[model samples]
Target: MTLHRFKTCATSFLAPFILAGVLAGVLAGLSACSGNEGANYEYDYPTVSSDKFQRQRLEELEGGDETVFGELSIGGPKKRGGAAAGEGFATVNYYLWRATLETLSLGPLESADPFGGVIITDWFTLEEEPGSQYRVTAYILGRQLRTDNIKIALYVRPKGTGKAKMDPHRASAVAEAKLENVILSKARTIRATQFK
Candidate 1:
């Protein structure tokens, strides 16, 4: 084959493959950049400790297992050792979980475990107060629709500019209590809708 004809055929054959590779790289880069954008918030909880009662309650409810709904098959055929039909087993209080997520929608969710009934949010800075940020960890104790079934831990931190260091602080008792009340109220509203 002539050099000119060989060169033309090679360029035509390789063009589509090269374009596909470049497109794939760009798409991968974009996805990676956006995948964990919620994890960008920075904060630390220094003195906060996990609640023993909550942990014990969760263990009891979960039957010491981390899987949701314990061994029950959902939306599919029954499995061995699974809950019987009409048993109505659930991992967490759906009302409380939904309410907590809606209340903390401003923050980026870091982790959520429905079986453990825990929702953790990354530090979120208020637009009006750039120097201050807050993080939240919420626990839905059980399936019961009760006020006491929900628990929350709120953490606040003040960012320092220049040479100053960031210091973490637990939100005030009153503020924490207020947030809990807000979540509970929202839960009630959501639960009410189910009946109507």
Candidate 2:
């Protein structure tokens, strides 16, 4: 009787383990039969193609004209006096159509994050002429978020031909004007659409 009770207790204890092993095998077989080799792949973020963005921007500026040019650049600031090596900032510049580059719309700068990037959503109308080109320089300021009084300047010129012969100050002014014109025009369009 003693032997029989011991055997029964052992069987009960082993029963759960045996059941778990059987379930695991069954699951493995089902997974194999389902043709799932555990080769799941995923991309976390939306893949933003430079070409795609440029094309989209150009299309917006061209009013669906279907003829447009788009270019983009991204890189760090040039090294200056030997403060720290490999510590610099970079910017992504975008130029769409053939509008001249002018102003940068830099967002607020915080002490904790002293420097910020700008996105220039530029819109303008120009007379149809050859070699008419526009450049939009997206300036990026690199600041030390923590230690040291380090600041770096980085810029990327949107892809285009021709040149706007203006000094930095004048270029900024022109850009601001263009931006204003774009905003005003867009607002007018919206108003007209609403009223109509």
Report model 1's TM-score to 2 decimal places. 0.52
Q: Estimated TM-score per prediction? A: 0.52, 0.22
In order, the Cα lDDT scores of the candidates are: 0.73, 0.37
lDDT by residue for model 2 (22-139), tens: 9999999888787756779877997889999988755443332111111221223334346642243332111211111222232222122112333333322234423332334332
User: Largest lDDT belongs to which candidate?
Assistant: 1
Candidate 1 local lDDT, 30-123, one digit each (tens): 8888876557777886763469766765554333222234345242332234555324444565667788889989899999887678899998
Weakest 10 consecutive residues of candidate 1 by summed lDDT: 61-70
Which regions of candidate 2 fall more than 4 Å away from where they truly are?
A: 4-132, 137-175, 191-196
Error of 2 at 126 (Å): 5.7
Q: Against the true structure, candidate 2 has what lDDT? A: 0.37
Candidate 1 global lDDT: 0.73
Scanning candidate 2 in windows of ten residues, the lowest lDDT window is 92-101
